[model samples]
Target: MFEFSLRQVALCGQQPWEEPGELAEPPSDLAAVIGTNGDQFRDSFTRLCLYLARTYDDAPQTRTDDTVVIGTEYGNTEALTRLQLGALADGKMLSAKHFPNATSSSASAFVNIGIGATGRNLTLNAGLLTPVIAIWQALYALAADRSSTSKVLVGDVYSAEALLDAKREANGLRCRSGLTHATFVKGREFRADFDFTADHEAVVTLGAQIGSDKSIDRNGAFVTADFLDVIQKLDVGEQSVLTCRGPLARRGALTVTRQNFDTVGNGGLGE
Candidate 1:
């Protein structure tokens, strides 16, 4: 089990789409924050990244050493589809602007650029389990490099286009479209433990320990939102956990404890 401090959390729920088969409008101030004339961030995915990145940038305690890990199941689906359709129809590439957003990692790249983070950056596409997996990656990074000052920024975004794609592919699975961000620091405000198991016993055991009152189950596409709610409601010295079951017989569990800093030391894990 790896552990870290969840210092802050930010989230943006599904934005209104005026029409079907079109990307949602970006936040009004997004262009100003990114220093653009509303041209660079045409796609919803990049806009969402910038919006969340601005949260970290605007924070008073923003750190220079930062790692970014973003997860998405259907990344920039509208741009990718447009690219594919353009290629198939005319045998010509789509607009150069759309080319960069076609890849899954482009959103994360934009986030790194938006926040000016120079440390390690990664993107993952693990379907419904993406958020939990991303958190696990962040915890692992912190645990592996104890002396590193880098704080991990982990997040996931699902656009309306992604939801439409899910409907087309998954026989209307009713996926939610939203974005969430959480920052994990070196000090201990929460302790997250990861588990990879084929059976559900681990989740059951951890669930019992955390209890139904304090635990939240990963029942939908965006469990991070629920996890954030629990964190916000938690009092100092309160503990909670989030559990999920992933594909290929995999399970994950994250235990969070709101530490009372008055009594607890700043050292985490091995220290």
Candidate 2:
């Protein structure tokens, strides 16, 4: 048996300097994450990941055998919007090299290369379930390696400036770096509905409860007892405290505040 007590986790992101209620930064990691839209997407993501790994996860290193998973609904929208803006400005096709950095997988790839991490790497864009699923998947990998240490980095990056004009048509999760909101709701579902104005970014660090017995899929849609691997059918708005038991085990609970049952398995309390 893996005799270890996994506790404490930290999250860092580009949130407003004033509204950080439960978050803290000694020197200003948040400041370093903010920049000219796409220019800082990978920077913010990596810095936040490094900070969380250092502050919360027990195993800390620039490069490790630990696996890394990333999630974001709209990543590098700034790069896309910028390419559009540049084309409009010059009336020409945007350079191909410019948009590759805009791909949703960019951040995770950059982090993997920067840290020289040679373990499993994953990225997702399944809306709200993205973060939850990434965390669950990371837990699965870590649980399987009880003797070794591991951590998960679940975050989001959205260019607030780019979304400002699109907010009216922009359906969900307006303008934010996406670190904090991802952290707050990744594990625990937020019951209240809220709206973001603009020029905001957030980052969230996700950690597993010490002894949860539930096994959650990558998208956090279906959950099961880790030991039995039996899928537990859930209903909309049905809340439950959760636990996990497996190779990567934990004990904790997050209430299922809501579930968006899309045919694509896009299910969760907050999606």
Find the candidate with the highest lDDT and give its number: 1
lDDT against the true structure, per candidate, is 0.55, 0.40
**Candidate 2 deviation (Cα RMSD):** 14.4
Candidate 2: lDDT of 18? 28
lDDT of 1 by residue, 166-267 (tens): 555432233435566666667665565566555544333221113354322221323575675576567887867766554445556567776644332232
- The runs of at least 3 residues in candidate 2 whose Cα sits more than 4 Å from the true structure, single-residue gaps closed, are 1-8, 13-62, 87-100, 143-149, 161-271
Candidate 1 weakest ten by summed lDDT = 262-271
Task: Identify the leading candidate in terms of TM-score.
Answer: 1
TM-score of 1: 0.72
lDDT, model 1, position 42: 41
TM-score computed on alpha carbons, candidate 2 = 0.47
State the local distance difference test value for candidate 2.
0.40
